[model samples]
Each structure stands twice: as C-alpha cells, then as structure tokens.
Target: MTGADDRGIEHGLPADGPSPSALARERRENAADVLASTLETRDATAFVHAGRGREPSIRYCCESMPHGRTAVAYDGTTDEWLVRSADASDGHPAADLAATLADRGPEGTILTPPHVPHDAALYLENAGFEVASTEAIARARATKTTGECDRIAVAQRAASAGIRRAASVLADAAIVDGRLAVEDGNGDTVPLTPARLRIAIDEAIVGAGAFPAGNTAVNPETVSHPDTDADREALRPDESIVLAATPRGPSGYYGGLVRTLVVDSDGGRERRVHVAVTQSFRSARSLLTAGSASVHTVAADLEAEVRSFGLDDSDEVEATVSGVGLESCEGPIDGSDEIEPGAVVRLDVAARVDETSRLRIADVVVVTDEGERPDRLAAPAHSLSPAALLER
Candidate 1:
C-alpha cells in the first residue's frame, strides 16, 4: 500500500505522471522483482539493508523515515517492506537492523548491497542470518522509470533557468579596457568574473527551487569540473566561458545542461573548439538510441567526430555519455555493454585547447525505445556568443 513521505517535497509532477505515493509504490514493486530474482538465485530468505539509502527516499519502504538512517528488507512475498524502527541511541545501524530482524521472524540467508558495513554483516551473522551482497539494486536504478523521467524533467526546467541566467549576464556585460565588466543595480561598474558569474547562476538555480551543487563550473578551464580559486580572476574579451547548469530537483533527481559562450571573439581557436564540441553533442546524442548502441560505442564515436574537427579531448575526461539518476554519473559506462531503454544520460563533450583552455557542451538526454531517436532535456541550442544563444 502507498504511504505518505512527510520528508518528501511535493514537486508537483505533471498531471499525467505518477504522484509521489504512486511512484514510490512503483519503485518498491520494481525493486521487489529484482530482489525476488536474486533471492531465487542465492536461495536467500530475505534481503535486509542498514545505514543510508541509495536515494534520500524511495527506499524499500514507503513510510516517512523518522530515523537519521533507515533499514528495510524485501521478502518478495508481500507488498510491504520489512522495516523496523529504531533510534540512534539504541545502537549503531547494523546492530539495530540485526536486532530488529532477529526478533521479527525466522533467520536465513539475507542479501544486501556490496558496501553494507562489516559490523552490519557481522551482526546479522551473529543474529543467525547469513548476509551476502548483490548488484541487483544498482542494476535496477540504472534504467529510468516513467516516474523518474518525469521527475528529472522537472529538474531540467531549473537547470535551463540557471543556464539562461548565466547567459544573460554574459550577454549584457561590457568590454572595458579589454576586461569584461557589468553594472550593478545602482549602476556601479563591477568586473564580470567566474566568481561573480557563479553567484548569479547559483542564485537563479536556487530561486527556481533546485540545488546547485553540481553546476559549479564557470570558466572555460573548469568546464567539466568544479570552480577553482583562479575563477576569481577578471574575464577578458574573446575568452570562452563555460556556463553549466547541473541542479538537483526537489525529487532528488539531477539535471545537466552546459553551453560554452564567448563575450567577444576574434574568430580564433575558441570558435573551432566550440563548433567541434557542439557537433559532438549532436552526434553523441544521436548514437545513444536505446538498445541500438552502447555508451562505450557512443563515446568512441564522439571522439572520432571531435577529431574530425581537428579538436581532441583528453584521456582525463570522463565518458562522453553516462547514465544520470539519483547520482550525477550512474552505471559508469566503461565497457562494451548495450544501453537499456529509459536510460537518462548526460552527454559531456569537451576539447582541450591547451593547459589553461578548453571548450565543452553538455546536456541530459534520454534514450527512447528501439528505432526512435533520443530526446534532449532542454531546448536551447549552442552558440558562439552568449547574447545570441540567450536570445533564443
């Protein structure tokens, strides 16, 4: 039965999408199927977990977690999850869960995630339940559910707002003495730097009701990563700025959007790199058709496409295409494995121009069923100038 999550925010999903309680029901049932398969394979009695959930909510149980940490199990027999409420003062998480399960019912082989604490496993063993680890839960989360997609789409709106805010700031700045500067509300002149730009972007994201933790990059050099102390430096004309928006929505789902822009350009190498990365985004987005290709193949194809434009990404860069969900990078596409449908992935393509210069464009995209093209999370397209891009 579906229950309320007092801790969960009412993200107000679209009318056609599942409600929070409905989505929670779908998640646990879907997770139960995977757990049942694992139980059959391992001949286990039930699956128990302790400590934190992979996601803030939507754990095996649907009730509001009253504890700092929660523990729940799946028996695959009932629609309900095996949950035992315990306080932190009682003991550690593993001890609490072990004690809770010990008194509840018969003890047998129990499965868990690989990272389950040693003490937790030991406590379970001491309590007469054999504990083993399985990758089933992780596997289940990789494929985006219908409700998860809708939640991510809500997050995407916030990301788009942040990107637009950042672009608007860059587009309105004036080139004074070769330095980019902007006027305050009082009409006082101030230098437009990454530090200033990040504040505007983050505020915009927060105003849109999303967490801006993942969208830290503002300078060209920090495109794919976090901000640096050097980001405090003043921006100069004709330099590329990578404005990224990777915010987490109220639903705990993440959204990603990145665009490289220049205040003014002499039509130099920055333009070439921008063009290359943009094409990489388009081509990589195409190759991520669900069931038609693997992310590994798409990354390789992206490399070749960027190479065709005389620009190349560094080995240090992450996989050009990777699944996104509760975490920013999910499933870590590293090998030749076919991507499943309903997988939401981030396409991050960057070209290295030197030690201090790089250009990148990234977007969150979802793979559709076979023979259909993938879809982008946001609508804005790439442009060399922030002004023209924001105008769209």
Candidate 2:
C-alpha cells in the first residue's frame, strides 16, 4: 500500500511491500520527481500524458488496463499540478444514440474516442507542453533497488518452475489420436493439444503462486519431416514445442521463462543431444554470477557453451540470449558491456539433431553478483528425460 516516507509524501512501495499497484502512483510520483529535478536544471514546463495500464494497477503496474489517456501538467510558473482526462475517470461517455433511437435502449449521444492517452505527447503539445528535446525514461527504470531485485528474483523462480514443468510434459511425448498424450498426477491420460496444454500450464503456473501472461507455439526444422512445412506445423509425435511465459509475484515485479522440447519415444541420440544442450544451460547458469558481463558477453558465452555440445557446425545451430523484466524479452544485451545490477537476463541456446533436424532444448536464467563475476539471474539447469513431471 502507498505510505508516507521520511519525505512525508505518499509513495509507492517496492516489490516486497504489501501492495504493488497500490504504490504505483507513488512510484510514478518518484519518477516525476526525478523529471522535475532534471527540469529544474533547465527552463521548460514538463507536461506528461500517461496511458492507462493494460492490467489493473491503480496507476500503472502489472495491471495495464488503459482508461484511455490522462494528462498531468506541472506548471513551473504557478507551481501547481493539473490532472485531466476524457474517460469516466474524468466523465462518462454520452449515451448510445442508436439504442435510444431504435427504442432498444435509453442511451444516446455516444462520445467515446477511439484511443485516449494513445497520443499523450501529441495531446500535451497541443496544450502547450513543449521541450527542447526528448529523452528516454528507460534510465529511471534500468537499475533496481535491493527490494525490487528481490521481487524480480521471486518472479523468475515462478517462471522457471513453469518452463521446467512444460519441458517434463514434453519428455517421452508423442502424438496419439490427434493429441499429444501424457500421464498425469492421477495416472490418467492428459492431452497436449495446443489450447488445452496452454490452459493446463497456466493453471500450473498459478498453482505455484504466480500468473502466466502469454503463450505461443512454433516449429522450425523437423526430424520426421525436416524440410517440409510440417516442421512449422502444429505438434505431432517427436516434434518440438516452444513455450514462453511471464510470471508475476504478489508484488508487481516480473521475470520470463521459455522452454523448447522434442517429443520422443525411445529417447536415443535425440536425448543425448538434448542432454548436451542442458549441460550448456547449466554452464551458463554457473556463469550468471558473473558481475557486469555485457549483453555481448552473455550471448558469446552462451553460443560457446552450446557449441560445446558438438552436434553440428555453427551453421546448424541458431539461438539468442536476451534481457527480461517488467516486460518479457526486454532487449538483447548484444555487445554493450555492463548489464548493470538490478537487471535480470535470460540466456538462450538451441540446436538441431542431425538429419532428423528436430529443434529441441532451451532454458531460462537470471543474472546476479558472484564475487568478481558479474551479477546475473538464472535458474539451475536440469536434464530432460522422456516423462512429464508436475511442478508446484
């Protein structure tokens, strides 16, 4: 919940605090304070138009539901703040005229604009909020406090658990009766159909005390049908399914996890190849404590480790290592040195299994400080067998 700090102004609490969204306004106010301080060094009135959240946070957090757009103007001259909006938060839309005309309803004179707050900067400009230049607000969000970092860690744990469980369900998996079948907790059969599987995994994530934000499936390269469009098609026996999910803790901080799997019957060479990939994942996890390793270092190290698997030439493998946070796939550290503290990153690596060409195996990681090693966030890497295990 929002509380007055020593400054005696109500402010948002960090992730470990009792309320996430309740404190969002406080956090935004702190950000505005930073803006104001910076503005004080210059000579311009700062007017900010913030969009509604997609979720349901009071101001903006995990709850991003946008209530159109809201405007906040800081008048340097008057030393006053003004808030305005077109939505109900400000005023309700006129009633529906068509419904009233048809006698089907009593509403009339609808006045809803397509997208509010959608053009905040433009709106501010129209209302006279001008500046010499625009700068990115990302810096304010980059580094994290100890509490924010802790909350991120918890979110990462939740995401990791979800991916690991999905991987288990893929092990020893096969297409049966137009559905990927697996044994469940009750020894009853479970179907791995796309939509059904998504629902089940989402339930698993929530059961672990987190929430799943999104799900998607893709196929590239194939064993049974490597060169054909079949590889890009839906799951069948011995195919790979990639699942990515973001989990949020009770606090609003978030982390990302991704899983790549190959359905197999006997788990022969395919299993060995997957096991090798898993080992590389473990190696990356071991290195995550590396302090200030640039995005480049993370990517290079992951590529090197994946090559350690020794399946094919570099041309045969494709993968990416990136940053994760409030938004999944934050960005690729690429080659910029220094990911800095408070940043959580996921290093990904993948490969195909010879002529079979099954694209299989992937993992999630976090970066953290480890003595001289740059701080990185990553989960413990584990091998994949041909069996699905339920994760708490």
Best by lDDT: 1
**Runs of candidate 1 exceeding 4 Å displacement:** 1-18, 53-66, 77-79, 88-107, 220-229, 290-292, 312-319, 332-338
- What lDDT is obtained when candidate 1 is compared to the true structure? 0.70
TM-score of each: 0.86, 0.62
The whole-model lDDT of each prediction reads 0.70, 0.48
Cα-based lDDT at residue 178, candidate 2: 59
Residue by residue across 209-255, what tens digits does model 1's lDDT show? Answer: 66776455686455333345567667877777777777776666778
Candidate 2 per-residue lDDT, tens place, 237-267, comes to: 5545655556665555566655555455357
* Number of clashes found in candidate 1: 0
